[model samples]
Target chain A: MATIQHPYLLFLGDAPDQLAAKTANGVKVWRPEWCIGQFRLPGCKADLGLPDVSIEEAAAQGAKTVILGVANRGGFIPESWIVELVKALGLGMDIASGLHTKITAIPSLKDAAERNGRKLFDVRHPSRDYPVASGKPRPGKRLLTVGTDVSVGKMFTTLAIEKEMRARGLNADFRATGQTGIFIAGEGASIDAVIADFISGCVETLAPANSEDHWDLIEGQGSLYNVSYSGVTLGLIHGAQADALVMCHEIGRPHMRGLPDYPVPEIPTAMDTILHMAKMVNEDVKFVGVSLNTSNVSADEAAAFKAKTAEQTGLPVVDPLKDGVAPIVDRLLAG
Target chain B: MATIQHPYLLFLGDAPDQLAAKTANGVKVWRPEWCIGQFRLPGCKADLGLPDVSIEEAAAQGAKTVILGVANRGGFIPESWIVELVKALGLGMDIASGLHTKITAIPSLKDAAERNGRKLFDVRHPSRDYPVASGKPRPGKRLLTVGTDVSVGKMFTTLAIEKEMRARGLNADFRATGQTGIFIAGEGASIDAVIADFISGCVETLAPANSEDHWDLIEGQGSLYNVSYSGVTLGLIHGAQADALVMCHEIGRPHMRGLPDYPVPEIPTAMDTILHMAKMVNEDVKFVGVSLNTSNVSADEAAAFKAKTAEQTGLPVVDPLKDGVAPIVDRLLAG
Candidate 1:
């Protein structure tokens, strides 16, 4: 992950609220000063309070890359946005998009970027050379944080565990597999964005060969119980080939995110599902600990739920943000 | 699924004995003469008793479509096979490949096919327009047979259920997803071949709006517990929007297919996982029955295992072939 040449412009599409909450691609704003300003659709609310500028203004402000930072349902980039995207490309701005719709695949936008001698980075476009999972045990200690459902803090858990491990002077690195994780880590493939067949291969390349003493904190994606996104979840699990996993869950997500009818599986059931999934590729895989996301709950409620989860799972449980992922990191180190 | 115009030539690249097992793609031999024998590498035994012929010779024998029938690990087509494939295409024979490596994507192969006016039917190529799962309850009663792992009789169970249902005057069709199922039914896409994100969409296209009384028996691929292939499983589960599920397992199997290190999950746990996974998309989804593959066990063992599974799962159990899937079909029909 080389330093992305700076002076970026964030494209906030039709919905500015999504980016305001740090959902989807909003995490890129963590380094806000580098962003010249945001470009939103005409009449679209700029709820995030960033200066809304036109494509010409953004370019004048030294925006070198236009980052499409608001994700819509199905990841379909609006057709109207292509006109603005072309304008940005014509203005000598490279396009960086994590959407399922590849900007490079759009003929008009592609021609504009090519004429401008600018590049298009379709982050979801997978590498062609990812090798299939060999099922043989690989060297190095790896730990993946699987969640009960999406937005259950899998990335946070992995980062927290990696942070704790680094604090102890152990060799560990957080492997990002989504937009936010990639933005945070500066280098990582979006696992869910990789083509289904090559997801494991993409994952394999994310954390290349490491020494047996090195611990790669591979981030997990969608839950096994998430029917819509479980394919990515399974691919990540098999691809990571982790020696052990830390299960992550929000304290009271009764149903899948945005899918109220789909009830979240109990912590034990979720653990069993993930373990069963992991054991398919790595027989030695075990549950190292649990990371509970108690953001919506009180501190006392979080602690009570954490204790209950630990007792049920017979694993150390911690809220990665509140109490730190020390218990899980310690377990991994001890093991 | 349209009629495949095929006077077929089976391509068994490296290992000939694998196709002899009548597993995976070997069941394409269900229609023997459509196959103008098999084409194998020199010195590789064609143990299935099909005459070994060269691609040129097979083309002369009126083979219209060359079916890459034997699945290799990772579906990697040998580079040398491409030379033979191009020669086959040069002779005006359409190539029907189920491999993960798309023949149509190969530049040489594509050019040859285009020049020769021969079509490349990559059965695994998913339709680009698969809609994301809306999570709405769809009309009609659909049943998907989920297996403990790959090769655990999901297709066999599905076909048997369809047979029983049809025999009982119910309108049930076996929706095929694998090469064998396609060969048997004369139509179906290999769901595993589809890009991971579009698996559900492919499944949706496989069985469109059916009458309320109709039952579509979707042939399942891979297991929810099999980490390497669970993406396809979850995709099929959600895409089918099944009302009831039939759990399938092989008796006395100790490990995941191909992966020797990973042990097979117990039937109850496997059932729990499938049910939990299905419930995430279709809240009304239920396990109507369990179908065990008792090919390895004696009749007595099979019967005892069926009885034990019934007791363990509290569902009707049967070996779809030997015992007939009538018990399970009856349960589904009853429901």
Candidate 2:
């Protein structure tokens, strides 16, 4: 099997008018790059898990894809994000996600995933996980879930997937995590306290599946990689012991707004975000795929962008919508 | 003061590109009736709030001028923002806010308060009463403070103000809000949540002075009213709540790069931001100014942008570094 690109993309935004047109003579113009920019998700406080925490710690914990979710005011989510993910995954890839949303429907998401033979383990919600050393009985595969609860958008997406899977004569179990968080930006004693509480809280509701590995990792977020606000690089690499990676991006217009004053936004175009996440998580890896968020944008736009985006990033755009998401798992198996 | 004709203007950036050139295009011009579609800002989510909850809430509560706080990564705080605010205040005009940030030191922040015949309040990181009803035995005048730990550029900008003010002989106390927040959506439950916490937890620590009633407003933030995300109306009637208002903006070459798809590689322009904030904040009371964030862009390009941005917005170009931030604040105060 050929290699698959890592999945995971972070979409950022400046705004609509800013995204739509710029004044050449005090008039506006529609920019083509707006598509790529929209996919570059900024770090969200709600999703403050990225950019605020350490990448190494997250990668260490078997967390490869770190979601940079897009939470904008207007109802705007693009299909390009999932398309970007699928193309990056190569022909067949299996992966989890850095991005989760109840905004998009689940049936649609599943169809999108299956179209490509890719498998998306739709643990769309975030739940708490107990440390294996707690000496308590553990939950199984459920321990690797990302969110404590599927967001309003993610929850909707999961339910739709279940209904559609059943209608299509497919067997599936849609899962949701029941953990909540009180975010604390600290390390050493403080982080331990926060992490212990966070994990314990998750366990109270959902037992860490016996699948919870013996060893785990903690990741940092934000530009201050060593500081709090961890982005989940180490947990995926160290804990998941990833053979490859993929970052999920919403893939839309806002991702391209560059803040000159801030240096972090300077490095990655939406395309670069996918490559960088893969690099940050694994010291050695050749390619990766991305999950394009295709909730609001048109399919033509998504496909056109997928091709352009993939070509630019040197990774083929994987249509998570067309290809089943599990193929990414195959990459893990191949690795 | 005779009311200024076309007292209001709107700045819009549909996308980013050679903005200076766009504003400079030689063609039949059409002036916008209320809002503008030109100019942009040099700031991002870092400046407003990120990672921290209180700061995000503060942005929603304190925006006395317009939703400048809500522009997020789209634009800079237009120099006109301060300019108009100062002019209006000194001249005794009505005002309000759409975002969450400090005032007074900027001048327009003092809502009709006078100290020895001059505006008593300076743009100190002043705390205002957040309208949150807590479950505690309440003292009407008890102090409530909300801290904003901003991002790299923002923390630096905040620190710069401290340094500049102190260097120039101002005695001020600035406490770190610990960390900043990245994404604040609207002035709804999310924003209210953090501010409510501040009202509950920080009352004891604030130790309000008996004479604190001298001040009457909070600051500006993003979630309260941004064009896309939060939907704070950009129209003057629906914008800021200041007696008068001033907006500050950075004008540059990244013109059509207003929207997301295009990443002009130039730092996000600040033109559309200033105008948008200005329009949202007020139409009549004050003059607008420009603080081109020329720090990163080439001097040739930056210098080349001045006339175009000013002419486009119909606001005076004020250099924030040279003219001082006070004049703009004074505009918002009806002295």
Candidate 3:
């Protein structure tokens, strides 16, 4: 994986709403010091609260990369956005994007980058070869966030824990595995984009041997019970070799994401299956906490669900956004 | 997946030993009627016991494809063999190979095939897009052969069961997922070569819905216990959604294949884990038999091991090559 340079100029190209600029919002919230300014096309309604700067102005302010941070419908690069990207490339700013579209595949963007000797990073597509996983344990303390289904706040949980651990003066870093997280971390592969044979190997590469005292809070994807994505989930679990796992769940998920016929496994069932698989790689693996996405429930219901889940699993339970992850951090540090 | 045409000319290009031709040997043993004749280059030591014919003669005899059946050191296509392959393509025959080297990537061979309007199949590489697995149970009976470790004869066991079921006038077809199995089955994607997110989806495509009584004997890959490849194994299991499963094992003399520190799971442990995961997609999933690769043991030891395994698991036990898989087929039919 290429190490994406930062001091980023975030491009919110014609985003119709703040939600479409969620990727940009994540980067700004997580790495404020690394961001220079926001660049929005005409009719763009989203703002990052940074000064709106033109490409030349942002380049003069020492921005090294232009990040395409908006996710519009269909995840395609509009023809209107090409000229500005070409301009950024000619101005010696490399480009990075978390979009499903590969900006590097566009001829104008590709030519500009090549001509100006700049790197183009399509973070959602892996551009390097990864060796098959060796399955040898490396020296690092790692915590992974696994979920019962997709979009269950695994990323939010890990990021929250990283923040809490850092604020407490502990040695910790968030290792991203998805597009939004990649922009926040500034370096990591999209695990799902890798070839099937190399999923575990890619994870091994993402979180390699670090200082034994350091905690690498690796982001997770998919779920063991999700038939559509369980393979990716299992690969992530095995490759993570996590010493600590935090099960993430949504309080009122109707079914496994996208498969109406499949229901999400109960918290205990999900934890048991995850622990059973994670133990294959790390015998010392244990669940330190449960993180709930309570967006679908009332505050009273959320509190009740948290209390009941804590009793059922004998672990710390918290909503990362609502209650903070300090309790999970306490448990992790205690261990 | 492209349906490779039949009446194949087996290309044994200077193989160093009989084992080097093992893939070719598998095709000959399983689908003898589909093979036209063997074509050997000078200094080749491996033979399939078929009449040796030149490319022209094989084409004249109605060969539609030339199959590369040798596993040379490092799996690279030798420059010396390209001319012959090009010649065969010019003679209006498609080419297929399981080598790590893709024949279609070679300019001379690729151009010849293009000029002649013939196809080139690199069976180990997937050439199309696959949707994420839906996880919805489709109609038709499916049996999946899972194993305790890699290279423990999952493919052979499935082939044997398919053969037995067909001989009894049962509706059964062998669905291949690996390179060698693709050659035997004539068409199927290499599951390991798919994008990580698509492993299960590829399997679903390989064995789509069939008649209610028909059986798709899907070949399995990797092992849920093998640390290096468990992700592939889990993906295969969930994608299979099999109604019946046959556990394949090799007794004695082993750690997990290629991982010295890991031991293969015992029969009961292996079956339990597989059954648990398979049930995520198929609630009625079951173990119908155990297929032992008893090549490591003497006849008496093999018999003792088979008897003990059958007693322990309460499933029919057989060596697909040695005991003819009759008992396992009997159990499958009875179910």
DockQ of each: 0.36, 0.01, 0.78
lDDT of 1 by residue, B1-335 (tens): 45566777777776656544253245443456576777878645445567878988998889888777566556566777889999998887887766657777888888998899887776666534455554656677788988888888887788777767777888888888887787666578877766666677778778777889988889998877665666677778878888888888888887887667777888898877777767766778899999888889898898888888889988998877777877787778777
In candidate 3 chain B, what residue range of length 10 has the lowest lDDT sum?
A: B72-81
Highest-TM-score candidate: 3
Q: After superposition, how far is residue B103 of candidate 2 from its true place, in Å?
A: 32
Q: Ten-residue segment with the worst summed lDDT in candidate 2 chain A?
A: A179-188
Order of all candidates by TM-score, from best down to worst? 3, 1, 2
Q: Which of the numbered candidates is closest to the native, going by highest DockQ?
A: 3
Q: Candidate 2, residues A219-314: lDDT per residue as tens digits?
A: 211111111111121222222222233433444434212211222222125224323322322334433343345655788887886777566655
Q: What tens-digit string does per-residue lDDT give for candidate 2 at B41-152?
A: 3421121111221212322333221212122123333554556444444443322222234344444355443421322211112234332111122222210011111011
Candidate closer to the true structure by lDDT (higher is better), 2 or 3: 3
TM-score of candidate 3 against the unseen true structure: 0.98
The clash count of every prediction, one per candidate, is 0, 304, 0
